[model samples]
Target: MEFGILSLIPPIIMLVLVLLTRQVLLSLGAGIVVGAFMLNSFDIVPSFNEIWKSFSQIFYVEGDLQLGSIQLLSFLILLGITTAFMTASGGSSAFGEWAIQRIRTRKGAQTMPGILGLIIFIDDYFNSLAVGQVARPLTDRYKVSRAKLAYIIDSTSAPITVVSPISSWGAYIIGLIGTIIAAQEITGYGELEAFLRMIPMNFYVFGSIFLVFLTIYRKFDIGAMRKHEEKAQNTGELVDPSKEVPGDLNNEFKATQGGKIYHLIIPILVLIVATVTTMFITGIQGTPAEEEVSILSIFANTNVNRSLFFGGLFAALSGLVLYMFLQGSKSSTGKVVLEGIKAMLPAIYILVLAWMIGTIIGSMGTGEYLADRVKEANISPTFLPFMMFIVAGFMAFATGTSWGTFGIMLPIAGEIAATLDVAMFLPSLAAVLAGSVFGDHCSPISDTTILSSTGAGSNHIDHVMTQLPYALIGALAASVGYVIFGFTTSTILSLVVTLVIVLVVVLLFQPKQNSIEK
Candidate 1:
């Protein structure tokens, strides 16, 4: 029963296979099968049986986990439908025309996704898919690399969610911290307060956001990204050299004769309003007013997956209605909606495989095993925050889920923090949050990463390769920043140093070139 180091084997195998093979589904499926074998104590028959059972349970079981997965899948399906409808109705074309008149340069093209990513802080899933669908046309017009568009979408999603106070990520984090505080018997500690204090210390998220702007403003591109961008500029190929994305994806949405920008604006507004209202209503459905008075409390308790499903459905329906009126033909509406859902089938498949692998790893206890190694190691209190950051990053990178990393590492970090100076608590907490995002950002197996690739229509491997360098730089800067925070216990000083490190590193490594123009 005690797998010990064997618990880590599945994730390690998955990571190796991904890097070597660049085949995500095969790699994930193989990793899950290997983990199943381990779970069945190396009995080939039972392992094979277990794999099928797990797959069935993941899709059909009447449990929260199964429901959650279904909710996510539904959201993705609806997102695809909404996007397709927007294109079919000529909403995307209208927006493209409007944006073209305003956005006249490469930086402007790049900035739009980043801005949208930041604005859509309700959920990273929504941010990733929506940004890609909305911005792909604009980026293509300027010949921005699909890799770069992916980078922008990827950078903004997890980082912004982790930092925003009213997102699904924020709620999950608060719940994790609350449980830790309760177990530690730490009195008078406010989860929201502690989270607020750690915001400035979340170096990687802040650094990544800042790096996005700095890279854009200074016309800076380095490493694989620089090469990809140059290729896009010179040859107008926005994807990697070896990849072949269908031109229909970019050109299929012919503009309607008189489609207005309102066609796009109305549905998106409805989606946002419906989501927020649903969250509040869901939050208040069962709780007494006295207990759930605060908006934060309401948000923290709401079923985010369900809300997302409903929101996406509403948005898709709204889009359908708009298209019906525009086309005045039910068959045209039905065909376009089906096309949108079909477009997302590949992404949905990847998502299902990723979740299956995550489930298998969870059963193997990959994250806890990694945490145990870190906890058992003799680490000093002063250096614990920095060390925890690395440990959390590795665990997340291997498992491809920062949420899983948080569930495993935060309790351990909280227990350790209780024994250290009071000032050390926030830095340790921030380290875990920042490092988890870092790992998720760089991980090829991460759902958000896959969504980013799907959204930008980039080759998944190419997106991973190009974005990894930027993520690493931000990680390195955050690691150094945590060390400074550990020593000084000054959030402001630590934050300033981290920003300086990121800016300096970016400027130093930047490729010198004339300002980019399409």
Candidate 2:
């Protein structure tokens, strides 16, 4: 069952195909076939049969891997509907008009998406879609490149969620920690406290946020991003025309003449409230009414899929009602909602493909193979955190799933850290979290990355290309920070050193202000 070197072939093939062809769907499909072939001992005919068999059973109640792929697809569909409703009702325009008065400069316009993305910390999916829908108009008005907008959305989504203690990412990581603690039988350790200790040690998220700010304030652009920004400024083309542009919700909606800002604000508020409230309700679904529970317990126990689905559905329905009121036409509102769902059909296909590939990768024991390779390296305890960061990043980049990387790496890191002399556990654990985000940020097949492009209406490959250098910068700085923490074990010193490194890198790559045409 252990495929060893063969396990690495699928992801490598997928990445190569994506870079060469810039076709996500084709590349993912090819990867799945290749993985299936490998699983079937190199029988090409059976590979085709095996892939369909496994993919169809993705939602089957046979394994713990049933991630409710349909539920996630529905959540995305609902979010798309809400986004369409907002745009169609002119709520987005109203919000943009309201925001433009307070945020006049291009930098502020570009920076606000990051700020918005940061605060929408409940789920990365919501953050990516909502931030893009709200900020695209503002950014376009200022000639900010869609690539940059996509970068901000993608960066802030996973990075912010990884560090947020209340998010789905947080719950997953905490669950991983709980399993580790229980399996290792490590006494005197609480999952909450352990996760809290890793917060400052999560250097990648901090470093990524800092890099976004640097880009916003200093106008630093390197590699493809610089060219994208320059083209946007010179031609006023917010998106790169050389690449295939993804479909957006804009064309589906006819913005009303005098829509109020409440149309936008109220729906978003309802969505957030619904998501949070549903999380609590689901968290206590099985508990007795007399039983007292903590918020953390609720978060830990909540059904994330149901919460996101209901939250997005409620918001979409609310937006539909608001649009109906504003336009005074039920048919028109219904039409916009349908069109919104249509707009997201491509994204839905991409999400489904990503999930399909993810399942094949897991079935191949790809994570286990990669982790075993790292373990065989016989890395020293001091270098474990740094090495684990690289390992986790590579695993995530290859697999295009940070959660999968966490599943594969966290327990290994925790088990190894348990035997260490000092408190290396936190740093090692943080390394896994940071590295996972770094890889996911750069990966073309990543769901968040794809959704960011879809939301910003940018070219998928362009977003990946422009964002790669920035993500690499953050990853490199975080790697160095992990190394420092591995040695010094001082959170403050490590962060200071990491931030300084990031600043220096930014300054080195900082584009000339005059060249940017402020």
Candidate 3:
């Protein structure tokens, strides 16, 4: 089987299996197996021989494995270990208990997660997992729906990351922007410099973040999420198990303490500070020192991962120390940390599988084939960005992985932008990032989606099902914004108009009330 037709086979098989059985893991596994079988179909004996070869090539240092696969696996494992360690130390639970003490009203309960999500914009991965973990209990305490919590977490993750100039996402986007400019033969425009110039024009990123804040602070509800919220309020049902903490209602206030809140706040603050400092020192945007000391050189010299690994390690350690010092052994800090790690096991497993599947897809040359087909289509320059956005969205959704989407889209988008003279550079780059985020936000297979559910203690399917409508609203808004920016003279106006329309729709429809009941 040629790779092109073989590529279609996995998704088709996955779709049929998923629809017939509704088992996500089984579907994903079948897709992986199909991809592997396709790769080995040329020769049974040689293919079986190559299976171990392929696996080792992808997993180990040798072979023709994709570097992105290795980076993703390393990051996921580190993330899992860090998350497990943090929870094991009791920091996550302590934060939740602390937040619950202050959230008395229903509105406050609902808004708190949004606020936390906004503040944790240092990294999307951090923001998605940490906010979900800390806010779930508080949201549950006030009878807030699990779907709502997942929505807040997912909405905040990619949107905030896109806007934050200091994040890992920022660095990646800036690099892509540079590639677009260079490919287009644009002179005198540095990568970071070009990105900064386009910041004002990156309306979707900023607008999405602003819309999230509005949704929370203004109590705006839309689509299915509104329906869920209303049902929870009417029935007083706990939609999420993580929301159910042990102990009686009358004694809830008595269980609260001022010091518990500080434990949560301080560690988060440390992580943020560390992230910023690391980026700055590394000169992610090419510091003046880059003339003599390259960012890559600095990273290689300092063993940066070790620093982040230890930084997270110390943050967990400090949280435990505080727990013991303040609670005087009543806190069971060690037990708390242990439980947190145990809690994250399921998410970790899912992420590992996702990475493996992504690796197989990459190894099979899917991205190159897709890019070649796209190039042959000869799309118009004016429609390029909009089309790219749609294509990227579909690819990410199909793969259930945004980073993988970027890995495939960035090079193609850069090449396309280059071919279109210089006029389409910024718009093209924006489309790729926006599309990747759109799929990640909506896809049930995404790591962020799984993590959000894990953090909220909600069923993964329920989170995916409930969050889809709201995500689509944002995607529609973004799509319109992309079209206007891509093809028209009034890019900023298009963005503003699109955002305003989406906000109005959300406020008016208010889906939380209706969706939750179903």
Candidate 4:
């Protein structure tokens, strides 16, 4: 049952195919088949069942459609329609025209998405989708490549959420930490305190965030990102003409005349407010009567899938009503809705395949096998954190899921540290957290990366290719910090040094400058 090293082949094959073919759907499908074969020991009939059951489980449970997948898909369709409605009503165009007067520089335009990503930390999915709606027009007007916008959106979304205890990711991690500590019977600090302690120790989070701001304010791009930036600036093309970009509906719908900035602003505001309120409500409802309701309790218990669905519904309806109020039946109601749904099909297709591959990868035990090997590593306790960071990064890179990495590696790291040296516990776990983000940040199959591409209207592969060098730079700096942490358990020293490394690299090594003026 334990395939060991063989578990790695499917994801690796998938990654290779995606890079070469630039075909995500086919690559993901191939991964599913390969993993299925491995899971079934190459028995053809059983392998086919493996593939069918993996997909069937997503939509069917006990003869009824599964609520979780249904809710998520509904949200995507609604969000797509909401985006379409904004365009059809001319709200998007109006806001762009309005912003051109105030925002005079490219950096100024690019800065807004990062700032918005920081503000919208409630959920990464929301942040990825909403930030694009707000920032895309501005960034496009300034000729910032869609790939660049995606990197900015992605770098901030997970890194911010993973660190902020109020966000969904923090809530999940805190719950896991509490469970691990309780099971281990080692408790000097509670879950909240433990999470707070790890925040500063998360070196990659800060390194990646700094890189994003530095790239925007200081003007730098590495690897293929430079080509993307140069092309965008020189030709006014935000995306590669040859590559397919989702969520970009060009000339498919006309912008209504007499559009106002408020038209664009209100629907998104409603969505954010609605989603947050639902999270709180679901959190409260899920809590026990005896338990005292608190901030931590709210987020930990909140139903994220349900919240997104309701939020998307409310936002889409608001957009529709507003469009009708303005256009007064100028465009057929069905036509606008259809266009919006059409724009989001590419996103939905990519998402479903990504989910399937993730499921298949989980079954193949790719992450678990890697974790087991790392668990068996015969290394000094001082290097435990560094080894964990590297292994966790590779596992996530291969499997395309940081949350899965956390589930598999955190307890193992906790157990290892508990057995070897209790002092290494936080450092090891923090390294896993940081490394998971770094891997997820660089992965082509990562959901956050995919949504970022959809949101920014970039070719998915371009976003992955452009962001890899920056992610590696941050990972290298973070690895050094983990090594230093191992030798000396000084969070301040390690974190500051990691950030300084990023600063020096950016300030000293400028990739050949593009023609964009300061």
Candidate 5:
């Protein structure tokens, strides 16, 4: 059963097919079939049965209809319909027109998503989907390529969540740190302090954030991104004409003349408020009455899927009400609503396929095989963080799940550091966190990456190909910083040097371009 390196075949096959074919669903389906067959000893009937079970399990697990996947899908549907209402009512165009007057430049349009991505760090899912809806109009107006917008969204989502203790990601990571400390039983610091300490050592977090703005301000693109940006800026075509784009409703509904700016603002604000409020209520209700209720405890226990679903529901309702009020009862309210729902289908399809592939990869012991290889290697104490960064990066990229990588690698990193050198423990864990984000950013099948493209209305493959260069440089810089921290144990020195390296690399890789319009 321990397939070791053989388990790498399905994921590698998936990546190659995706890169060559540029068909996400087909690539994901092929990977799932291969992985399922491997899990079932390559038997024809059992392999297909396994695939069916995986697909069905998305709706029900443990003999109960699970809300986790269903709620997420509902939320996506609601988001789409809400946008449809906004478009039919002319709110989206009104807001874009309003923003264009004040924002003025392409840099200003690009700045909004990055800033919004940082501010909306409570959950990467909400941040990835919502920020794109809010900023896409402006970015399009300024001729910023959807690929670039997606890069910014992808950059800020997980990187910010992993670093912020107030976020869903932070709660999960802190809990893992607690387990690692208790399991190792040689801790001088508590979970919260260790989480704070690792923030600076998480060099990729800052490096990626800085690189996002650095690219925007410096006006440079790398690899395929240059072509996308130039095409957008020159011809005002925000997306690649040849490819399919998710969350693109531009051609579905036109903005009406009667719509007001507040129409767009109201639903978005409602969504944010409703989602946050639900998170608190659910988080509190889930905790036992006998236990203390605190911020971290609340976030740790919060039902993100349920909260996001309700939030989307309220937002959609608000948009619907606005449409009825502005467009009157005679207007085809159902049509606009349907268009919005239809707009999200492409993203939903891709998301569901990505989740299925993730499940099969899990069943095939892909992560375990990679982890076992890392365990067998006799890596030195000083190289612990460096090796962990590399291994975690690969694990996450192959599996397309950073959180999964964290679950598998954190405890292992703790044990390795515990045996090798206690001083390297936090650095090793930090490297795992940084490396996971870096790999996830690059992965074509990553959920956050897919949501980012959905949010940005970019072609999924275009986003993946464009973001790869920056992810590599960010990981390289973080790796260098981990090496330095392992040697000197100086957070300040390591962080400063890592950021400098990112800036230098960003500047050095300036794209060669034809005359792009200002």
Candidate 6:
């Protein structure tokens, strides 16, 4: 069935369906079916049989399904449970109350979300969900628009993850870089060291993060959502800021003050500590087996399953224990855990669907085909980073999945850089990561985008509508940065320059409108 031509069909059909229906899961599922059909194009009945085979391949390979579905499920479950616990323990509420008390100025309130986004850069999924979950109540308390919240959360998630060395992303990226080096039969450079070297060249990541901070500090608005933001500010009405919030609206303030601040903070701290301790014990730092362990290996190893889930679980447990000890009631602890899990349910469903679609795309060969085509184009060695960014952005935007984009582009980009004799591997890898993140940041159909909207409790369309302009601002800055690093100067210098430009531009162009009422 000419696999090349056949490969294009699924993505094309998926795109058409998505644009027409605006239903992500439906589009992805249809795409997967089409791909499977194409694989069995020679036989009608067999095509149907192949569809089941493909589905099973993704879900039941060697009885493991790679646990990809389960991991996503666990993440969602843990998110819900932890959120419930945090609320019940008064953690989320306490943080909000504290933020309200401390941030007296409007600009300060606007900037707070971005700041929090930066602090949680360890992983994109964690950053997306946690920042939104923790900051929504506070942002709402200050009458910040849900669109603004989504913008901040989405902006920070991918960019921060790309730059942070200790994140789930970092592990995947490092492994990929290592594989590329080994595949090309290159020697003399250690995997981690090579990655570290490339960080300076990863202009997009630094630029994006800079733009997010700039958006917050400068209050820039340039697109459809700008009107919404302005209207919200002028009317002083609470607009539905995020998609996660339900329509019931029985009480505006029920979840706002349900838990305490200490409950949230202590649990988060415990998670961090546990992650560090586990990393060291697991020897993720390329250290000797008998040597003293560094606190960084927990996430570096490939064997660790559900690390984020465990981290979330531990945090939730800590919150529960603290709640029980402080409130002195087992029933209270149970209620908190249950409620948190419930709050996280919607997000869980969305993530599961998103992951399934991503898995389907991989199984169908859509991602690989696209990657090979980009590679065949033979972009110039010097302009490779910028080109990689564009390719990644398109793939992620088209598919609405950053991780899938990375899975496709990273290997290709790495191999290209190796072919070009480029010594700095990290920056090239960082370019792929940055590009994937940029597209995901802006795409309405992206899972992270959905999760951010959910976490902010804003309307999904509203969040996408508002966040696009701001994301573009970051993307533009990042593109320029990528160009600089790829063609002209040092990566570190490019990062600094890009950051400055974005920050200034965003600050200079504040949105005209300021508030809205629900």
Give the lDDT of residue 24 in candidate 4.
84
Q: For this target, which candidate reaches the highest lDDT against the unseen true structure?
A: 5
Candidate 5: residue 8 Cα off by (Å): 0.6
lDDT of 2 by residue, 325-410 (tens): 77443337668878777877877777777878887888888889889887667678888889989999988888888988898899
Stronger candidate by lDDT (4 vs 6): 4
Candidate 6 per-residue lDDT over residues 80-148, each given as its tens digit? 666666665567668877888887766676677788788876666667666777676677676677778
Which segments of model 2 are wrong by more than 4 Å? 59-67, 185-189, 241-247, 250-253, 286-292, 327-331, 514-516
* lDDT per residue as tens, model 1, 262-329: 77877777777787788888876734666845666776777777877888899999988888788533
Candidates arranged by lDDT, highest first: 5, 4, 2, 1, 6, 3
**Relative to the unseen true structure, what is the C-alpha lDDT of residue 435 in candidate 5, on a scale of 0 to 100?**
87
Task: Tell me which of candidates 2 and 5 scores higher on lDDT.
Answer: 5
lDDT of 4 by residue, 326-385 (tens): 844357879989877777787778888888888888877888888888878886889988
- Each candidate's clash count: 0, 0, 21, 0, 0, 36
Model 4, C-alpha of 339: deviation from truth (Å): 1.3
- lDDT for 234 in candidate 2 is 89
For each candidate, the alpha-carbon lDDT, in order, equals 0.81, 0.82, 0.62, 0.88, 0.90, 0.66
Residue pairs in clash, model 1:
none
Per-residue CA lDDT of model 5 for 399-480, tens digit only, reads 9999999999999999989888998999999999998998899888899999999989899999999999889888889889
> What lDDT does candidate 4 reach at residue 456?
87
Native-to-model Cα distance after best TM-score fit, residue 146 in candidate 5, in Å = 0.9
TM-score of 1: 0.93
| Models sorted by TM-score, best on top | 5, 4, 1, 2, 6, 3
Tens-place lDDT per residue, model 3, 1-518, is 45774676676676577557656667777777777777877566665554455456555654455554454444334344444433433444566666667765666876777778877765666677567656765776667777777777877777777655556666666656666566667777787776666565555555556666676665565555565667677776546343321111211112224354456666655655664466456553344443456543332233233334444555555555665575433334444554544444555555656655666666676655666777778788877778777787777776777767776787787677777745776677667777777777766567777767765656566667676666676677777777777667466786786688677876776434333222
